[model samples]
Target: MISKIELLNEIGIALSAEKNSQKVLELILDGAKKLTNADGGSLYTLNDKDELVFEIVSTDSLDIHMGGTTGQSIDFPPLPLHIEGHDNLSMVVTSAVLNDNTINIHDAYHADGFDFSGTRKFDENTGYRTKSLLTIPMKNHKADIIGVLQLINSTSIDTGVVVDFSSEDQKLAESLASQAAVALTNKKLIDEQKALFEAFIKLIATAIDEKSPYTGGHCKRLPELTMMIADACDKDDAGALKDFKMTEKDRYELMIAGWLHDCGKVTTPEYVIDKSTKLETIYDRINTVNARFEVLKRDAKISMLEKQMTARETADEQAFKDAERDYEALIEKLNDDKEFISVANVGGEYMAEDKQERVREIAKYKIDDCEEERCNFFNEDEIQNLTIAKGTLTNEERQVINNHIVVTIKMLDQLPFPKHLENVPEYAGGHHERMDGKGYPKGLTRDQMSWPARMMGIADIFEALTARDRPYKDGKKLSVCLDILGKMRLDNHIDPEIFDVFVREKVYMEYASEFLTPDQIDEVDHSKIPGFSGD
Candidate 1:
C-alpha cells in the first residue's frame, strides 16, 4: 500500500545517511525485500576478480541469513562475469548486469532462456520453493554496473501465498538500486581518500626514520606506545584515569598525531641525530686524536734517548737514573691522558671540570712538522668536543635537536585536519612538554595539555628510555627504566596520575614483553620505585 514516491524518498535518505558500506548494502536489500514482500533477498558486489561476490543473504521462511552485517561467511563461489573469455550472461543476476536492465520473472520454474538449475538444485536440497523473482542491476553515477540486487519468492500480503512480482515491484526495486549505487559510490571514494591520506602520513614518518639508524624505529614505536598508554588510560575505571575515555574517532586522531609527532625530524641534520661520538662528523675524529697520542709517545721516547746519550757521554750514572725515571713517568702520563680522551670521545651523562682542564693541558703539547706544520695535540674544535658538558652534542646542536618539537608544531598547525582530528597538532606537539611547566616549545603544564597529549608524553619518554637502538647508550632494564620514570613522576617532569595508572596497569611491562630484549626484562619492586604506591 506504500506509494513508490514515498518509498524511493525514504530509501534515498537512509542510503545517504549511512556511513558503513556493509550496513548500507544490507539496508538496500532489506528495503527491496520489504517493498516487494519477498521471502528471500541477496546483494552482490563486483570484486577485483571480475566476479559478482555475495555480500549479503537473507531468507525469512527457511531461517537462513549470512554475510553483510550478519558477519556470517558466504561459502558460495562468486558468479563469474566472464568465463573462458565470453560474457557468462546465463545467470539471471549476470544477465541483468550485462544488459543493464531489470529482469522480473513470474516464476523461476517456468522462466525461459536463463539457467535456473542452481535455483532448482537449491530448492531440492532445502525443500524450499523458488517462484517469483526480480533481479535488478545496480549502476553507479558513472552508468557502470557495480552490483546486482536480487529478490526471490514475492508473497501476497493478504494470504501470504507465493505470487509474481508486479510491474510496480520492478519499478520500486530499480529506484532503490539507483539510490544504493550512488551511496556505495560515495562511501568507496571517501574510504579510498582516507586510506591515501593515512598512507602519505606514514610515508613521511618512514622517511624521517630513514634519516638516522640510531632512531630507526622511533617514529613507528612512539605511536604504538602512545596508543597503548592511551588505551590503558581510556579503559581504566579504578584510578585517576577512571574518567578518561576515547571514542573510535578520538583513537584514530591520536594515532595520526602519534605518527606525525616527530615529522619535523625530517628537517633535522642527519649528522646531529646520528652523531656516534663527540667529534664525529663525516667520521669519528677519535682516530685523529689516537694518532696524536702516538706522536706524543714517540716524542717522549726521543727525549728520553737523547737525555740517556747525554748522561752516558759525561759518565753521569745518577743523571742516567733520573732520566730513566722521567721517561717512565712521561710515558705513564701520556698513556693516562690518551685513555682519558678516548673515554671522553664516547660521550656520557656528564664531563667534569677536571676532565675539561686535562683536555686543555693536553692540547698545549705541540707536534712539530705534523701534517706539514706544528699543530696542537688537540685542535680548537677537538678541544670543544672533548669539553662538551654532556652527551655527544654541543650546546648549539642540542638546541637544534630541541627545535624539532617546535618544527613539529609549526608543520602540523598548517594542516587542515577535519573537525574530529582538530586536536592532532596540539596532541603531537605537546609530547615534549612537562607537567610542571618546565618543558620546551610552549612549556604547557599538566592543566594546559589534554589527557591524550599527556599519554603521548609518557609514551615518548618511556620508549626512549627502553629503546635499545640509540647510539649513545644501551637500553635500560625494565626495573631501571621504571625507576627513572618513577623519579620523573616525583619530579613532576611527567604526569603523576598518568604514571600511576601506567604502573598500576603494568603497561610498561606489557610493552617491554613485546619490544624489549630478554635481558632488559627484569623483576621490578614497587616499593623501590621513587613514586609508586601499590596496585
Candidate 2:
C-alpha cells in the first residue's frame, strides 16, 4: 500500500524548484513519466474555456517531432478512459468545476463502447504500448482547475506490464497540478510588468513633444528615423547587428535612446527654441534696413539734381524724374538675399561685414552740413560683437538660444536612467557642438564622443538639414542633404566611422522612407539596403 507521505513528497518537489513555466512543466511531466514508467508523456494546459492551448512534450524535437499529432494540441476534446457512454475527461472536468470528490474508477480503458478522440495521436504517431491510464484535475488553493495531469501506461509497480489505475497514483497527480497553478500566476505578473514599462516610455516621449509647438512631430519622427537606420543596418548581415542578433536588450537600448535623445530640450528656453530667424528678438531689423534704404533714396535724388545743375542739363528736366531706381535695386537685393553668396550682401537676417561698412559709409559720414545724427549706421566693431548679425538685441536674448542645451542636460540629469543610459544627457547636449571647439555648452571633440553621442549628432544634423519648418532657411533636398553631410564628415565636423556605416548601409534611405514628409519622400533618391534579411 502506498502511503500519503510519498505523494506529499512528490508535490513538494514539484513546487519547490523555481523556474519559468516551460521548465516547470517539463519537471511535472518528468515526475508523471517516472511514477507511471510510461514511454513518454505530454502536458496539456487549457485555455479559459477548458480548450487545449498547448500540448507540451516531455521529449525534445530531436526525439521524433511527430507529424500526425503525437505532440500537438488536438482538434477534438480528448475523452477520458475511466467512464463509458459519458465523456470521461468531461466528467472529470465537471467534477473539478463543482468541487466533487468522486474517487477512482477501475478498468477505465476497458470500459464498454469506449472511443478515444486522442487515439490518432498515440496509435498513429508513436505506436508504443499503451493501456490503462490515470488522470486527475490540477487545482490551486482557490479550487480552480488550472489544468489536468495524466499518467499513461499505469501499472502495479510490482508487475512488469500495464494494469489498473491505482489509488496511490491518483493522489500524486493532483499534487503536481497545484504547483503549476503558482507558476501560471507568476507568468501573468511578469507580462503585466513588461506592458506597464512600455506604456511609461511612450508617455515620456509624448511629454517631450508637448514642450514646443514646432516639435510636436519631433519625438515621433526621430524614432522612425532611428529604427529605419537600424533596419538598414539589419539588412546588411544575417538579420543581426555587429555579431549580435538584435536581441531584446539592443532593441530596448535603441528605443530609449531615440525617445530621450532630445530630453535636454526641456531646459531650452521657449523663445530661443522657437526663434524663427537669426534676428528673432529685440529688433525687426528689416524695418531698420527699409528705413536706411529710404535715406539712400533721398540722398540719391539730391545727387541727381546736383548732377543735372552741374551739366546745365537743367534742374527743371530732372525735378520730376525718379532717381530712386538705383536705391530700390540695392534695397531689393539686401531684403531677399540667400546664404553662401557674396559678403557684399545685407538684410533679411544678417548683415555681412562689407555690407555693414558700405551702409556706414553712406549714413555715418557727416554730410559736412547736417543738423544731427538721425541716421547713424552700425559701425563694424558693434556689428561683429553681437550674436544677432542684423538686428540689435540685449545679451539675454542670445543667451536664451544657447541655454537650450543647458535645459536639456538639467532635465535628463534628474531622471533615474539605467546604467546603460548614463550617456543620454551628454550625447544629447553634444549635438550643437562643432569639431573645432566652436560648438556651445562644453564643446566636446571627436575623441571625447561616444557612439551614442555621435548617433545623436548625426540625427540632429540630418533632421535640421532636411527640415522644412525653419523660417530663416529653406529645407535642402535629400541629395543635397546627403552631399552636405558627406562634406561635414570630410571636414571632421562629423564622425567618419559613423558616416562610413551610414553610407555602407544606405541608412538615410530607410530614414527618408519613414520620417520624410510625403512630398519629400517622393523626391528623395533612396539607395538600396544590401542585407535586409529580417529572419
Candidate 3:
C-alpha cells in the first residue's frame, strides 16, 4: 500500500501533468476524497459572474457521478458569492470561499453558525444520514481564492463509521488544493495565449486576401485542402505513407503553416497579382495600340485621295484606279492586324511561334506619335508584354511574384516558435519547392523536405488550378484540374506517395463538392488521369 505522503506527492504530479481541464478537475476531487477516505465530494470553480459553478460531484455510497469526465451535468443552480451587494455566508462552501479558511463540521445535523438545511433536505429525500463535512478554499500562488473543495462523511478505517476530518487531513487537503489551483490557472493562461496567437495569424491571412479581389479566398481554401490531404496520408496504412501520423499538436502546427504558406505575397505588388491581360499595367495598353492603328488607316486614306486627285489632273485613269484598290486593301489589312493584336493581348496557355512573329511584324508598321515624331507602331514595353509565350506575366513580373516565398521564409524564421511548431517555417516556405530540385527560392529535393511541406505543395497547385476568382482565367473543371495535377506528379513536382493517397482517397472530389461551383464539377475518369495507375 502507498503511504499517505507518497499518494499526496503522486496526486500533485498527476495534477500538474494533466492537460485536459475536465480531467484536472476530476483528479483534484478524487485525490481529496482518497486522502480523507470520504464517502462523497464536490469541486466548485469561481466563474466570472461571481458564482461558484459545480465542476464535479461524486458520491460512492449512492453510485452518483456527475460533471467532469462523466458527461453528466450537476443540474444544480450555481451558488452566488454575493447577494444584494453582500457576501452570502449562509452556505458552507460559499462561507469557506468568503472567509478564505477551512471549515470542519463534526456533524452537519448539529452544526452551528452555518446553514445545513440543503444537506438535511438531501438526506431526508435519499434516506441517508447527514454527518461530518470538511470544506476548504482553493487558493493559487497569489493567495487568491479560485474555488472550494467540499468533502462529506469521512468514515473510520476500521469501523466504517462517520468521523470528523482530523487536523492532519485538513493540512493535506489545503496543500493539495494549492497545487490544483496553480495547475488549473496555468492551463487556462496557456489556452488563452494559444487562442490569441491563432486569431492573429488568421487576421493576417484575411488581410492578405483582402488586398486583392482575385485571391479573395486563397488563404482560407489552401488550409482546408492541405488538411484534407494530410488526413488522407495519416489514415493511409499502405506503402510509403503507412508510417505517417499526427498528434493534435502536430495537426495544429500544420494548420498554422497552411494559413501562412503565402504570407510572403503580402509584399508582392497587387498589379502583378491581379494582371488580367498581357498588356495590363494600370490599364490595358492595347487600347492605346488600337488608337494608333486608327491613325495609320487615316494616313493611308489621305495619301490615296491625294494620289487620286493628281491622277485625275493628269488624265491617267489607271493611276486613279490603282489608288482606289490600294486604299481598300490597306483598310482590310489594318483591321486584320488590329483583331490579331486583341487576341494576343488576352493571352492563353500557349501562344504559337507564328503568332509571336506576327506581333513583331506589326510592330514595324510606323505611325506619327503625339509629339508628331515618327516611331514604330509598338514600343519596346508593349512588344514585350504582347509577345509573352504563356500567361500574362513577363519574366520580370513572374520573378517579382516568386519573391514572395523568399519573404515568407524570412518572416517566419524571425519568429521564436515553440518546439512543436518549430517546423512551421520549413513547411510554409517549402510549398513552392519541387522533388526534382528544380523549384525556386530553394530547390530542395524530396528527401530534404517534410511530408507536410510536400502536401502543401499539392494543395497550393490544386487550389490555384481550380480557383474561380482569379482574374486571368475561369476555374478549370475537376477532371481538367486533376489531369494537370497528375502531369505535375509525373514530373516529380510533388510527393508521389501523398499524391497516391490524395487520389485514392478521393480528396479532390470531397473538396470540389464543398468549394467548387456546379459548372466546375464535372465527371472525372480515374483511369484517364495521368501519372496514376488504377490500382
Which numbered prediction scores highest in lDDT against the true structure? 3
Error of 2 at 202 (Å): 1.4
Rank order (by lDDT, best first)? 3, 1, 2
TM of each candidate vs. truth: 0.95, 0.57, 0.90
Query: Which residue pairs does candidate 2 place in steric collision?
Result: 80-89, 235-531, 235-532, 236-531, 264-408, 267-407, 268-404
Choose 2 or 3, whichever is better by lDDT.
3
TM-score for predicted model 3 compared with the true structure: 0.90
Which pairs of residues clash in candidate 1, taking residues 3 or more apart in a chain or in different chains? Answer: none
Model 3 Cα lDDT, one tens digit per residue, 216-307? 99999999999999998999999988999999888999999999999998899999988989999999888898898899999999999999
Report the C-alpha displacement of residue 507, candidate 1, in angstroms: 0.9
Q: Is candidate 1 or candidate 2 better by TM-score?
A: 1
Which digits, one per residue and each the tens of the lDDT, describe model 1 over residues 7-83?
77887899899888888988999899888889998899988887999999999999998998787899999999888
For candidate 3, list the clashing residue pairs, or say none.
Answer: none
The Cα local distance difference test for each model comes to 0.89, 0.55, 0.92
lDDT of 2 by residue, 475-530 (tens): 56677777677777767777665565666676776777656665664343334222
lDDT at 87, model 3: 94
